[model samples]
Target: MSWQMADIWENIAQAIPDKPAIVDGDKRYSWAEYEDRAARVAQVYTDHGLKPGAKLAIYSYNSAEYMEAQFGAFKARICPVNVNYRYLEAELTHVINNSDSEALVYQAQFAPRVAAIREQLEHVKLFLEIADGSGEHLDGAVDYETALQAASPMPVIERSDDDLYMLYTGGTTGMPKGVMYDHKTFSSALFTKGFEMREMTLPEGAAGFGPLTQALHAADAATRSIPACPIMHGTGMWIGAMIPHALGGCVVLFDNSHFDPAALWKLTQDEKVTDLTIVGDVFAKPMLAALDDAQAAGKPFDLSSLQMMGSSGVMWSAEVKKGLLEHIEMVIIDSMGSTEGSMGASVTTRETTESDKTASFDMAETTRILTEDGKPVAPGSGDIGLICNGGMVPLGYYKDEKKSAETFRTFDGVRYSIPGDYATVEADGSVTLLGRGSICINSGGEKIFPEEVEEVLKTHDSVYDCLVVGVPDDRFGEKITAVLSVSKGTQFDEGALNDHVRANLAAYKTPRAFITVKDVPRAANGKAGYKDAKEIALNALNLEVA
Candidate 1:
């Protein structure tokens, strides 16, 4: 039988019941206690009439209860949907409605936003709010702790490997959609040994799993990991929450709404964190800056216990990775993956080659480059193709058949997840990822779709037309830039345009800089010319293409 995540957690809890399972700020939960808390949360959901397989939306900052709610949903065979806390009213309402969420669990700080959209979300039958040091509370919403304490702990329900693990991801279409994956496939991507790590084979079968499970508990000391990114993201949740628990280790979370390098370093030294996960240069740059400042101040943090530091989603520059290696003699695994697919080409700083630094990656054995004609492109062919992952992929986007068909396809009788990433297989068989074909802007690991920003910018009174593009940056891998064609004789007000976008969408999606153009360039078919807009922004910013 294929292993389910809930079952795996139960097995690990049985093996290491007294060990710390999760440490969030000042709060800690032992393995046994964590399971008990999850059971209570699950019972609360059922008591509220949330049935098995019902969808629950988690909308909050990184917290222990956020994870408890997630595991509880898993225990109850309920699907938990990750809601980006950065989303404003419109975006939040769209996702909650699209997911058919029956219940919403959100932080009290975001109560105003939720309250604004509550009238539109008729399907959401229950609201559970966690106090965020704010005295604010939404009317008619149940307190999270009150509900958890009142409910009786329920027995773990039988779950199949086919249980749903849904992740809502923003795409080039300018809206967020849920990517659907069964627990079996998700586990294969997260837990199974990759081709580069070991022999490429399926995860242990039922017959071979007994000894492995026993050895997993007996042979290894308790490991500790800190997820520097938000748990709402795939990298943070998997590396920080799920993977550690699955391995019977401890997951430490910083108790802050924003990332703080000093606090993160302090926790690492204090807890002796074994694993650390980051997202590209946005995280690495600040961390390195803080480390440098700490050493100069004569109180260098002892990160000796850190075993591995990894990044996913955005680009973790080679310079930053090398700097991190100086502080700790460990490899930096710069994983290139998305919510739609896992384990593509991972660029590692293990061997430290001169040229193969940041964007270059060693393709996984099952990963391949397929041309538009559905033929495998040979290495060094100089042909651009979609970087695809074969075997045990997601089912498809929930309720979006058009996108699901476009993303997951079958070629030569084998199905693969083609996530719209353009790459070239180098002569040495390494892959040099060009970028996303969808033109998604990644600013500090946050995905910002150009159309989403463009739509907002065009709504400005001074703006007649606009196109948004990503420009290279030192801190954030890419920053948002907007090229505009204002109304005749109307001057561009950057502040006004920025505030417009910030009011309508997440603040991060707002343009950092604006450039006036003669006219917004468009093709004959009336499509925005992103290439031209990108060049315009780069020239205006006086940045050279690296």
Candidate 2:
């Protein structure tokens, strides 16, 4: 039988009708109740003239309504676009216009931003605003809950396996481009092996079939997953939230807006969350600090219910990854993925050794690494370009044939999605992600990438966060500069930061100059906005373009 993404939910609702499906602080929804709410949301969409395959944009943070919108979109057969909550007016307008989104559902917190871009969003016909119990409303938007209440709770549409359910990639390099995925792609790429591998134990009869249904049921019964990341990025949308739901697990929403280690720990302990997905060092560092503070107080937090821990979004350093495992005493699965891919590019397993944990390669069999000349390279080859496959690789970038043709290519009669990532292929065939190739810096005669330097800089105790980039120079052609957000109470001295990097990295790779700031510029997904960072770096250095 063919796989249907919507069917995964149906199976869980039937098998575990009363099981907890989602939890947001004081609120909790059972599987049946969640489905009913999703059905009503679907009815609302249909009643508002959104047909199957129509584009609907969700511009909210992690919430019950966010999940409802996803399931509701599937039920209504509308293609849901997860808009980044942190996007400014220009960024938000670009996606809205590019995706040709017909309707937008957003929280009241972002009303001002929406109001700013509403005039520019030519394609958006309906604007749905979610109130934060403050009774505040955006001028030209309808109430979210009121619309749902007025709409019928009927499942108005049925989606086929080939119907596009997700638009995974948001084109940050240029304009946002949609990477369309169907129900079959979700079941095959995400459900089959991805969720199955995360389970501690499998049921007797649940071994062979797509483990998604059974996992959702078991997760709903046993585990509660805390998704700290926003729902716009694939890590936050698919791996962090949806997959947990596919397992019938409760999702704990961390809606603090900014990263607060103490608040996160308090939420986790209070919610009794069993599983947690850490994005990278930015997230993990604060969490570790909070844990340390708790330990120092002689009241070691009861994180006993925490069973499984994993890291995704950005790559975590070996030291940070080790620190987390040692502290938690649980297996840590570090993974690498891209927006063009269906989220699960590669993942480390429990049995993977410490040495293997540090080295980033262990990709699935379907994943491949090839050189610029299109020849495959052997494992342990220093740094080879990577192209991942299997699951729902995007059809093409929406509306940009030139980029679509270049990125989505056909080799050996099979189409492969290569989003310009470089990695090291280990002896055992695992892949270690280096960084994006497009942003790689060539300084003096050395090939330096910002990610490599940023990783080293993050290890510094005084540095809270930093972004590294290459600036045009007369002597070296391009010189490396580091812009940093230092820890509170720490001094921002360029000489001291230079010495720190010199101790860890090659002299040529270290940042030639440092600019201290309160925060590093980043996109909604915690990714460095290199262009923005470069602009800041150049202005600080008083460097002129040649």
- Model 1 steric clash pairs: none
The per-candidate count of clashes, in order, stands at 0, 13
Clashes of 2: 13
Candidate 1 C-alpha lDDT tens digits along 1-546: 657777777766776678788898778998889989899999988998999789999998888899899989989989999998877788899999999999999999999999899899968999999987898889999999988988888797778888898988765456889999898888766766332332324336323333443465576645688887888878888766676666667889876465688989999999999888777655776688789889899999999888778777665556667777777777667777788776454545546635545577887767779997688888998787888887657899999899889889988888888988877888988887766777978899987767556655655657766778899999999988989887655788888887888898888888888899877765321235677788888888999875
Cα-based lDDT at residue 543, candidate 2: 78
lDDT (Cα) of model 1: 0.78
For all predicted structures, in order, the TM-scores are 0.80, 0.90
C-alpha lDDT of residue 411 in model 1: 89
Most TM-score-accurate candidate: 2
